[model samples]
Every structure is written in C-alpha cells, then in structure tokens.
Target chain A: MTQFNPVSQSAGGQASFIAVDWGTTNLRAFLMNQDGHIQAQRDSDRGMLKLGSAEFESVLSDLLGDWLTPDLPIYMAGMVGSRGGWQEVPYQQCPIKLEDLSEHLFWLTTSLPNKVAIVPGLRGTGVAGLLDVMRGEETQLLGALDWLEEQGRADESPIFCLPGTHCKWAQITEGKVTQFSTSITGELFARLNDESSLVKGLPKSNQLNEDAFKKGVQASLQAGGILHHLFSARSRFVCGELAADEVRDYLSGVVIGHDVNDTLEALKVVSLEVPKSPVLIIGSEALSERYALALSSRDLTSEFLAANEASIRGLKRLANRQAVSANNPTTGAL
Target chain B: MTQFNPVSQSAGGQASFIAVDWGTTNLRAFLMNQDGHIQAQRDSDRGMLKLGSAEFESVLSDLLGDWLTPDLPIYMAGMVGSRGGWQEVPYQQCPIKLEDLSEHLFWLTTSLPNKVAIVPGLRGTGVAGLLDVMRGEETQLLGALDWLEEQGRADESPIFCLPGTHCKWAQITEGKVTQFSTSITGELFARLNDESSLVKGLPKSNQLNEDAFKKGVQASLQAGGILHHLFSARSRFVCGELAADEVRDYLSGVVIGHDVNDTLEALKVVSLEVPKSPVLIIGSEALSERYALALSSRDLTSEFLAANEASIRGLKRLANRQAVSANNPTTGAL
Candidate 1:
C-alpha cells in the first residue's frame, strides 16, 4: 500500500482508471493505477438512498472532480446498479464466475464522454431455501476470491463471511459463487439500541464492554435460542446481575453469535457437523474481530480481509477482464 | 359483564375499591365492586415512565377525580412499584403463592388521606439461568390463577402464557408461580417495524395479513432458526415472492412463533417432549389471537383470558387476603 500523496498523483502519476463502491448509505471512490494500486480514494454520504435519479451523474461528476476526464474508464458496483440506484442492472444468475462479471456489466455513456460499467449482482438460493440477492457484497466476495487466487488457494472452496448491517455468508468454488445467505443481525442490533430494554440506562460512551459481550456470546450457546436469549438483556439488568453499560455489547454478542452459528449450520452439506476449513471473514476490523471471536468460540478458525480492499480488488478484476475481452475478440464473451 | 353507564355509576353506585395496573407506557384504573365486578374503567397515558417522582400523587388524584374518596383503598401493581415508578417496591422472592402477595404489599399513606398498597414483583431464575423479574405481570398471573380457581382447576399445574411487549410463560403448580421465562418478542417486532429491511415497503395498515403471517409461522419451523428466518422477509420481497403488505405480518409470525416454541421447550421437565395440558394465554384479544395461532401451529391448544379481568381478580384476591389476615393476626405473616 502506498502513502496517499495527492499532489504527486494528481500532477506526475498517470491515472489509470477509477473504481466506486456505492451502497445504500455511503459511497466510496478509488483512483487506481494500471497495476491495481490505489492512488487516491474518497468517500461520501451521497449513497442510493440520499440521491434522486437525475442526481447520480452530477454527484459522481462532482465526487470525481478533475479525475472525470474524457476516455477514462470507470467501474462501479453495489446499490448503484440496483433498481433504486443510478441504473437498474439486473442480477447475474448463479453460479456466476468472478471473471465473467465484466461481460454482464450494465454500460452507460456519461456526458463526460466516458463509458461507465456497472457490475451486476448475484442471485441464488439463500439459507432459508428462498431466492436471495446481494448487490454490493458480491463485488467484495469476488475481490476476496481474487486475493485467495493470488495466494495459490484458488481450488479450495472457502466460506466467505461479510459482517455488516445484513451479514452475508457465501460459498465460493473455483472462483464461482455457488451459494450465499444473509442474517439481519447487525441491523437488528442497531434497531434494538433505540427501542430495546437493553438500551435503557445505558452508559453514554460508545465503547463496547468486552466482558459483557463475551458473556452474551456464551449465552447464545445455551438453550432457548435467540428469541429467549434476547430478553436476558433486560432481565439480567433488572435482577442486578448486569450493569446498564454492559447491556448493549451483551446484545451485540447475542445477535452476532446467533448469526455465526446459524450461518455455519446452514453451510453444512450431507448433515456434516464440523467445518472443513477456516472461514474467510471480510469486513471492518471491529466487526470482523467480533465474528472471529464468535468463530473461535465454536472451535473454528478464520482469515480476515478488509472490505474496502476487497471492493477495490473486485472492481479492478472486472475492469481488467473488460480490457482483455475488448482486445481479444475471441474472448469478448468473457 | 354489565353495560358501562357512567352517569348512573357517578351518581349512586357505591365505590368498592380502585384496582390499578400502571405499566411503563400506560395505566388503567378499574372501579370494582366488592364482588370483583368492574363498575367503571378508565385508562390513561400517565404510566410510571411518564410521571416524575413528585407527580405520582397528583396524577393519581386527578385521574381518580370523584373516586378519590378518603375511605377508598387503592391497590396498584405493575411498573407503579418499579424502580422508576411512584415508589420503588422491592421484589418478592419466587416460588410465591397468590394468597401470600397481600402480606408483602408495599403500603404507603399518601397526602390525599388514603393508604395505597403497591404489589411487589417476583424474582427468580430466568431462561438463561440468570435472575429474572416481572413487575406488572405477576399481578396478572395471580388473577389468572383466580380465574382457574373459579373454574375448579386451582390444583392443576397449568402453564400461563402472557403475551405483551415482553411475553411471559409462567409455571403455576397448586396456585403458586413456581417459575417463568420472558421473551422480548413484541418489542422486537415493533423495533423491526421501524428499522428493518422488512419495513421498507410495508403497508400502512396495522392489520395482520393472515396468509403472510401463516407463511412466516411455517418458515419458523424450518432450518436456520430466527436469525436466518428474519432475512427471508427481505429475500422473498427482493425475489418478488412476498408482497409489501405481507412483510410486516410475516415478520410478526417469525418472532412470535420462535417465542412460543422456545418457551414451550423451556417448560419441558425430565426431558418430556409433549405438553401435559392446554396453555392458558392471558392478554388483550388481538395479541392473544396471534399467540393462539402460533401455538396451534405447534399442535398446542391455548385458552384466552382478558388481561383486565385478571388484573381486577388478582387485586381483589390480594385485598381479600389482606382482610382475612387482618381478622387473624397469626396468619398475617403469610
């Protein structure tokens, strides 16, 4: 990783292309060199939910500033390609290969005289045996697989866990996304923060109480499951067993613990109880650490991949594939 | 039940006593005769959470109006005796009997010249093997037991299920509440309504969609448990399998179904799988109906009891017990 020297990159270094990961609540833009190294990056709150249909082009243009030069290819993924985004790019059906994502790109020619390609999401059967779709996380999964391939672990089928508001657990085999499931754990935790009995009399600081969190994780392993375990956040407090400040983290542990347990159980094939390999956890450091802790509790190991890096790698993979297909007519179909 | 004729009651009916159920969000005052018949009932928003420490007396006086006679005794339960309530009455230890509660009442003489007794809550081991306490529901359970006693089933060890913001499943053996477990199902449902992906395009009507709710109940019986089942609300919607109006009810079913299942499982003793008798569900008609549906899904039958009647009965029982103890000083210790 290079230290961000904005002046040096803006004046001397040749800008190769731009990659963007636009989600529901925020947007991240990365300027990358030909070698897939990020020269500069920017983030904004102008996500899909915050913009009007007509405002997408203007928002992107302003976000890019001087980088919006003619002939500069741009790649974008996530909610930016959803039905409510800048363009409604239909999801590519699974099992979809990471390399073929570029072929299914929804292309748009902006007023800046540059062609922008929006990567399509993936659709498959979820953990509940129902059709599930993920817009932004698919790109991250693709990028994480790219990291695995570079490490010579290409043939190993690994479970990718992405922790977020809607945590996703995906299975990838030979660079193809076979299946995935989502657990609304983080979203539920945030909701409980405002209205749950666990929130009452909570401490003002946002720092997590680790002891309480661990106790919650242990609680999740007990009988009664998530529904019964949830009330303990309040019941313990009322009985003077848990302090008010510890309630929030305790609830977090409960929710996240359930998510990890259920996801791992869902991943089982032929009624197998034990996991075969170490899971790949991709997300922010804090969330991944919590998931890692949960996985560790279950005698499972995990490897961490930063979500931002995965997104950039995924967008770069799509762009490189597009370039190769454009130059070689025989491989145009990707 | 007699028709509510306010003018007739205000003019000549002899006021027996005021039975009050003051919870966190709302308060109910029932003017009952000596026979436990309600002459008139009044509900207000000035619950424990809504009143300041000094405002309790004035609020109760104002709410009672002409019923605030010096000779009239007031018996209050629920959060009225909680830490944030009018007076922080300590909780009574569990394995408690209905006939013994009056002896443990926290009696207070107000400036209004009437002595008010607040019912103490019960504390015992919860579902997680941690200490649990229920403030208002203990009184309701007492009244529910009285209902059973009237039905000639007082000696039967029936499981009483109370559905509300915090649903409780209590085991009563020979008119004593031996133990109970609470599920934060209702609060979780309400929280999800505002902050969940399931609520994105939900219909404005509060009415439950029966078909959708049934589907959700069925979904709960499947693999992955509640955490994974929750995301199906969004997954099905994204796949065009579920309508916007169905999302809310479906989510409701998932939460309630899990609550019922876990509670019933927790009730099992000596590894017994089947429940011995029909579960008694005590609450408002609407909420009880939901629980009944979920219970039916599990091949379990449930009997419904109005929460108001139970509160009145419970309060009357406590008052009657106090009267009997007054006559026999040897049994006053309870």
Candidate 2:
C-alpha cells in the first residue's frame, strides 16, 4: 500500500536501481528511483513452480520487456535459485548477513544482455541440531531489518517470522541473521484440506472461525503429550458441532499450533536463554493476522509486515548497498 | 497362507456363496465352499475408487461369471459400503456384537440373479471422547472374535488393530467389538513419501527400516508437546546426515511416531482400569511386524494377525452364523 513514483527525481537524474523478488510460484518486480522508493511494481504467475528451469529466463525477459532493457541490473530472490528452479544456487548457512548473501550470489546469464543476480537461500542449524534449509524469504527479513533501522527503532536483536508456503523464523542480531528455522505449515494445511480425506467432505473457503482457530492453537500450544489433534477437526464435524466450512479454520489452527510449537521449541533449544524480545511477523495480511492472533493468545507481542512490501524493501536495500559500493571506493565492497 | 479344505458335506450337493473384502483401492474375492474354504480366489482392479457406483454389480458379475447365479448369496465387507463405495450403509454404533451388525444388516438387490449383502462399517465412541467411524476392518474384527470364540480362547478381551490405509483399532471383549478407533497414519505416510516434496528425492522400496521405524515409534511415544518431530525425517535428509534412500526409513519413523502417540493416547482414554492389556495388530506383514517391535520396546506384548486372514475368517463366521440362524429359529445367532 506504500505509494512511490518511479519517475520521481531524487537529487539527481540517475535512478537508484530496480529490485525484483522472484519466487517459485509468483513474480514481483519493483522499479525504484534513487531513494529506495518504488516507482512501479508488477506481479505475475511466472513463478518458479510454473516456469520451472528451462523457461525461467524467457519468462523473466517477457515480463520485464519494455519496462527496461536486457542490460538492466536485476536482483532476484526466493526459490528462483533452488535446485528445481532456474539454477542450482548453493545455500548460505546462517548466521548470515546481507553482505554474506550478496557476496555469494548466483548470477543467471541469458541470451538477453542483462545483469541478473539471484540471492542465495538460507540454511541454518535445525532444532534437531541439523541443518535447516530455506529459500527467498531470508532477503525479506533483511528488508524488514532495513525498514526498522530506517525508522530509527532498530534493536540489537530481533525475531522475525515470515509465514507463508514455507514459514521462516529468523533471529536477526546486529544486522545478521544468526539463526532461522523453516516450517512447511502452509503446504501441509493445503495438502490436508485439498488432497487428503481428512477434510474431504468439508467445503473450501477462506472463511475463518476465530473460536475454532483459537481453540486449536491453544490445544496445540498447551496439549502436554505428543498426540496431534488435527483429526479432531473431522471428529468435531462428525459430532455435528462444527460446520463443513469451519473445517478449514480448524485445519489452520492445527497447522499454526504445530508451527508455534516448533518455533518455540527451536528457539528454546538454540537460544538457551529465552529473551523477552518482541516478535515481528512478516506474511500475507490474512496469515500474518492469524499468526498475530496465535501469538497474542500465548501473551506474545509481534509486529506484522506485509510479505510483498518486505521483499521489495529488502531487495531495494541490497541494490542500494551494491550501488553505493560501486560508486564509492572507500567503503569495503561485499 | 493358511490353506483350508472345503467341507464337501452339506444339505445340498452344491456350494453357493461368495465372500468379498472390498477396500479403498483393492478388491479381493473368495469363492467359498460349504465348509468355509476358498474354492477359487480372485482379485481385480475394480476397487471402490474405480467403480463409481452403477458399475459395482457389473464389475462383480464380470469377475465372477457363472458364480453370480441367483442361488448363491454374496457377502461383502470393507469400504464397499462407505459413502464413496457402492452403497452408503449407515454405520453400526459400538459396544456392538456380531449379532447386532447382522440384525441391522441391509440387503442390496442387483440386476443379477444372486442376492448381495453389504456388511455395514462400525462407528464408536472414540478414545478422544468423540465419535470414531470405521468400515471394512470392523467386520474383520468381528470375524477374528468369532474365530477366537470357536477356538475356545475368547475369555480375555483382545485389542485387534487392523493397520493399513486407515488403521482400525478395535477392542474385542467377549467375542464382540465393544469399541474402535481409526487413524489415517498409513495414508499420511504414503502421501508424504510418494507425493509430497518433503521426500521428493527418496528412492522407492517396500523394505522396512526396523531401526528407524522403532526409533520413530519410541520418539512419538515420548515426545512431550507436538508432532513436529514428524518433519525430522526431512531435516535429517536436508542436513546430509541421511541418504535419500534412508529417507523412507525416516518417514517410517515419523508416521509410526504419530501412530504410537495416537494409539497410546487412545488406549489411555479408552481403558479406564486396564493399563497393560495385550494388543493384537493385524495388517500387512511388514507394518504389523514393525508395530509389534515398537510395542515390544515398551515391554508390552502384541499378537500379529494378517488382514487378509482376519477378513476371510470374519466372512466365514458371518456366513456360518447366518446359515445356523436360518436353520434353527430358537438359537440366538449373528
């Protein structure tokens, strides 16, 4: 919802740069003038899942054609660099900073004469004391950090959670992502509702049942034993207590319950000392609101960030930093 | 593979009966002799999923040929009576005896000359203090109970667990299924391994990883808060500590963990005074054996029964009881 003019002149005629956050299932393009203000923006279904590996460049070119020339520098992020994406960009293990990601970036060369760089995904130590992998969302967390800094409210350490197809919970300390964990909660919910017989009889809708959702989240967080109460949704339905449409809300609760539990557990194991830090949640409005509600039930406070805006801001910051380094020789170049 | 010899002696010289165990994706037929022996067995691809509705009888006729004569009576169990199956037979609520199911039995008249009877599935008060729904396997549990009674070993209550696509846990007390529960653990396991990207790169094999499966079962039993440990299999693979092929085992662990957790929770809620009752597990040899091993680790004893045998035995018992009831009016019969 933040509006910016692409053709606006900020101090000079030279535009700052364009930042494109390209992902597997969606494409987001942002044209920024000198001050990291988006001049124009566009989104399309040319995501990695749809285009796959071979057609990625052609699709990218097709989407960006006439908006800019092929030689225009574009910074990409998300699953675009995953193994199944356009290219296999190796993952950068956390604790990673913007500089670390920028230094180890993967570039895509096409017949089109353009400079395109893909930001690497983040892999971190998992809750089980193993490597946890994530793609695309790390840069958005960086953008969120930049936004906080610009607001002059940046903290030494912050916990940012980006909930989506793959929910990423990152710990940013001193501008570095010290650690993060990923949960495929969204995908799991979708699969259970859409494909599985668990909710085969339930109607499909975006309608949310606050009571059911809260109950599920609470049960998920408070249920002591290892038992999963996901099937309880159907059980509730069969009992004639829950309506068909409310099954979706119940499912959302189950998934969010598991997500909150996992994130809490991971933080406990890795962080050792539970810092009473305010959590920042970055996701779509609906999902972010749900996460906010779930967190609130646990007496946890958080700041919600829109996924698209966060990604754009994050890429803009990266482009600006790169441009600054390219213009001034005194600052150490990443 | 226990073979039974047909009983040659009957009121009539001819054998006129058919038994079927029709599940979600598979159909098995038994051409039975007067003595409850399989004269000729056949299987077909006309499972519930394939034969939408109108083709159920036609497919049976195609499979049976001359066996579809009017003089013969066809008895069927399993999903063929579910909502998606040939006919939606309302479930018989438990604390139900075999006699209760037979008393409320519904008959389906096909265009074919023969009489067809579809066995009703069971619904029960769930261990979670909810309504539990089940089909197909409940009839098999009844058969198992009949077989136990006939063997003169029916004093002790037995826990009959039919683990497959939908694992059914039935408590058979005094030659009757008093209660039951259903878990979608098997279906979930299959989907995660075969369809989901979580184990996208894993190799396919039917072999069981005993170590992984047992560890998974144990972990599921002990884990305190949530079922997120289910994803540890993927994490292990992503961490490079586990080979792609070994992912199957890790998945085995995840599913079994949840299974064990659910089973334990169910048992706790169902049995008020009895804490250490022996469980009878019936399923495919491999999965049943894995569950047995899992049970053994907790110093609990379990009896393994093949699903095929149990279903066959159940059908035989039902037919025998029906024959007896038809012959003698005063005798209380199932």
Candidate 3:
C-alpha cells in the first residue's frame, strides 16, 4: 500500500465532471469543477430503489437538467453501482489503498460515449471472519482517507465508525482499509420502531429521547446481550419505567449501543490496534454525535464528518486522480 | 410457597367447565368434564387481538355454539387476561408455586353469573436484572408442573423453554417458578424474514431447512454476536453461500439459536440453576422440536410437551381445584 498522499487535480478553471451519490432511498449529486470544487449541488428522492421502472440515464438526465453535458464525465457511487441500479459493478476486495479506487472504476458504455463510471464497492473479512460487504461507505471511507491525509493525520491508523441504516466500522492502517465490519443496528431499530410488537402502541417519531436513548445504550452493556436487552424497551415501557414516547429512542439506544460495543469487541478480539486517537465517526451530525455519545460512554473519544461531504470529497479526489492520470499518462501516484 | 399437589376433581362424571387458551393470534378451547379430560375441543382465529371491535363474549358464543352453556364455567388463560383482552388480570409474581395459580385466578363478573375467569400472567426478574414479561406462558408453566407431577417428576428443577412468537424461559425450582426471561426470537425472525433487507426478495416461508437452520445455529455461536451474525443472511446470499429458500430458515436458526443460548447464559449469570435434566421445551410440535435442535447443539438435552395440552391441563387443574374447594368447603387438598 502506498503512503497516503492528497491527490492534486490538474490546473483548470472550467467544470470537469459530476458526482452522483445514489443510495437505496435518496439520490444526491454534486457538480465538481476541474480542481475538485463543488460548482453546484442537487438532491432528489429518485434513488436506486425508486428507479425500478424509470431508466437511470433518463433520471440522471432529468435531474441534472442543463448540467447534463454530453462531454462532462460523471462518476456515480453507492447502490448506483449495485445489481439493481444503472449497472452492476463487481466489488473490489479489501486491503487495497484509497488511490486504487481510481484504477478499479467500473466505466460504463453509456450513450454519452465513455463519459460515465461507477465506483465499485468493497468486500472484506469482518467480525468472526464473516464476509462483510459495503456499497456506498467505501467511497465515504476513501473521502475519509483523503480528508485524514489533508489533516496531516495520514500516518495514524484509526478506526472509522460510519453510522447509518447499516453502520460500517473500518480499520484503516497506513493507507489501506485492512478490515471492516457492518452492523444492521440502524435498520433493526427502524424496523422495530416501526413494526415490532415492542413499539406497537407507542407514539412514533424520528425524534430522539436523549435520556431514554442513553438508558438504552447503558442497557446494551448489561448482562443479557442484544436479543434480551431488546426486550427491555418493551418491558421498561410496560413497567412504567419508560414512557410511551421514549420507547423508540430507548430501543434505538439498545441496538446502537450493542452495535458499537460488539464491533469494538470484535476488533479487539482480532487484536487490531484500537488507536488512542479519537475514532473517526463519519455520517450526519445527529447520528455522528449520537455515536460519539455512545463512544464517550465507554470512555472512547470520536470525531465526525458529514457523510455526503465525505462521499462528494471522495468522488472528487477519484475524479481528480483519474483526470490527472489521463492528463499525464506517466504519472503513477497523484 | 406450597408444594404442588395433584388437584383431583370431585367424584362426578358431568360436563363441568371449559378451558380456553386465547392468545394474540388464535383461541383454543377445550371442553372439560367433571375430571381433567377434554370432552371436546374447538379453535378459532378470532383471538384477543382480533377481538378489538368484536365482543369477546360474542366471539366465544359464536364459536362454541351449544358449548356456551350459561352455567358451564369457563376458565381462560393467556392474552385473554391481558390489557386489551376480555379483562385485564394482573400478573402474579414469581417464586410462587404452580398451585398458587389457583388462588390468583382473576374470576370475571360475567353475564354467566360467576361462571367465567381469566388466569393472570406472570412477572419476574430476567437476564441482567432486566425485568422480563410473559402473558400466555404462565398457564403453560402451570400445566408443565401438573404434567411433571403426573409423571412423578415433581422434584425436578428445570429450565422451561416455551417457544413461540415470544419465547419464554422459566427457571422452575422445587415446583416453583423462581425466575424467568423472555426472548423475542420468534417475533424477530418473523419480522426480519418477512420484511428486512436480510431476506428481501428472497423466498419466504415457515418451512425449516434443517441444514440451513442448523448452519444459522452454528453461526450464532461464532463471533460478532446477533446484530453482525444477522447480516450473514444477506451477506451469505449476496456471496452465494446461502440459497434463496434457505434464507428464511437460516435466519430462523440464527435467532432461535441465539435465543436459546442467550436465555441459558442469562440464567447462568443470574445464578439460577439450569437443571442437569433436559430443558423442558413446550410449544407446538414443530417449534418444540426446532428448539430441541437448538438446545442439543449446545450439548443440552430437552423434552417437549404440546403447548395446547399444557394450557388445557393447567386450566383444567385450576378448574378442578376451584370446583373441589367449592364442593368440599373444608378440604385443603383435593
């Protein structure tokens, strides 16, 4: 693996390409110029899941509007590269450096004539040596790496906690993503908070009950493990220890707490160097803070990055590297 | 708590009462004669949950037909006694002998003039001192004692696993329920297999793939715990390790296996005696056998009792005791 180096884009003022972050339920796009600056941004709910009947090209063309230049290259990340999306891109295996992302880009033979490519996802050995896969987080992880090197923390091997519907915990050593694990904590909480008997009659909201949520986090470290602690949400509510409105947040705490603890424990079990440095928590402000709180509860420190920005930045770097390589064919590393 | 004594009915061969096991999803009623024999049996899908708008009495009346005799005392158990049921009967605390159930039966002031009653639920300390609950399983636990005593196994102190949508694990010592825990394993599996991304677009069914189910059981014992292990259902499928039809049963195995292991571990942690004798698995034949497989995988022996029989036997014993005490005002033991 190469030592982490910030990719410097070629000197050009005009717009270069577009970056699309397509996931299961939402689509986000960033218009990037020659030097990795966001020219403009747009978002829509026409995610990969909703593009079942709608053609991906038509959706992209419609959403991008006048920005849809035939010559401007577009680099798409996330489920847009998944099986059901615009095209199925194979996942690249782990232990690969961030810069390698540019070389493995799954270029499309689109109607626009070699003007589009999808960032292939990553697969790695996760907790218990079980196979774990991530579609979108890998890009954010690359952005995370790029961001870290820019911060002059490139030599630091730290754990990355990307909390979302399916949270990803990546262990980056040197410049390579050595190993990572995935937790369905968010998705589990979503399903239970919405449909499980645990919250059957309770008031439903995305609003977090802070104290209740922390109580759930505390419950995770208790004797019974995830399957049992989950019942605490319902039992505590039944016993009047938790209010009806607090049930969802309390459950969220329970699952998220367990997710963080288990992933950390698994990393420890594998003898990974859990850095003394604060864990890099990459996601939205609310969730990242929630994770930071959970980590702090265990006396572990953490920092955060907006997931969208991470993806956009990561895609921007990839575009820059690809552009630089194309401009100077003799250049090996950006 | 008093030692469990077999409740022999009064000397008479007349149709005396009915035993109704009404839960959230289904209702089963057994017509009992003067003794503990089931004279007739009937079942309906109009369970307590479905009785939201329909009157419980009207539903019973429509289903039982001639069996709904005004004077035919009906002893009901399960969710029929829960908050949303026919009547809200309070839960009896643990450490009470099975026979104490007779004293706590919340007799209803019904249209039939003191001819109807709902057996209460049970509450107790569970894993990690977290309060766990069970509504319908109490009646089964009572019946379990009756059946055990009938088999001259009254001295047994065993872990009782009543598997269902909400699985119950009760620690029975000296014929008394000392402690118990509830695992939402079945419910979790139902929701995940039917709805989650783990099994999304995969084949869905209640059929168990023995190989796949056992593989899941093995997976539970591996690292990363439940949350991470759960993703294997999807990860394995995406990587072609698990087949489409096997996903449901595999998930079933994972949850059931964890449920069994966690409950036992919780019992051990709480310093409760997980008896050397086989864990008593009470439920439908298929579910009971499934649990037995899970238990055996941990090198634990288990025995099964038809859940309906247990409930019927329990309600029958309660009826016999109530009838005997009513028949002979001076008799303390029938």
Tens digit of lDDT per residue, candidate 3, span B249-294? Answer: 8888888888887777777778755669899989999998789899
Candidate 1 residue runs with Cα over 4 Å from true position? A1-13, A269-271, A327-334, B1-13, B269-271, B327-334
| Interface RMSD (Cα, Å) for model 1 | 1.8
Instruction: List, residue by residue over B218-291, the lDDT tens digit for candidate 2.
Output: 54443222234555556657767667777777667757656655566557655654345578787889888876
Model 3: lDDT to the true structure: 0.79
Residue A68, model 3: lDDT of 67
Q: How close is candidate 3 to the true structure, as a TM-score?
A: 0.93
The DockQ values of the predictions, listed in order, are 0.58, 0.21, 0.67
Query: How does candidate 1 score on lDDT?
Result: 0.79
lDDT of 3 at B266: 73
> What is each model's TM-score for chain A?
0.92, 0.88, 0.91
> Whose DockQ is higher: candidate 1's or candidate 3's?
3
Instruction: Arrange candidates by DockQ, descending.
Output: 3, 1, 2
The DockQ of predicted model 1 stands at 0.58
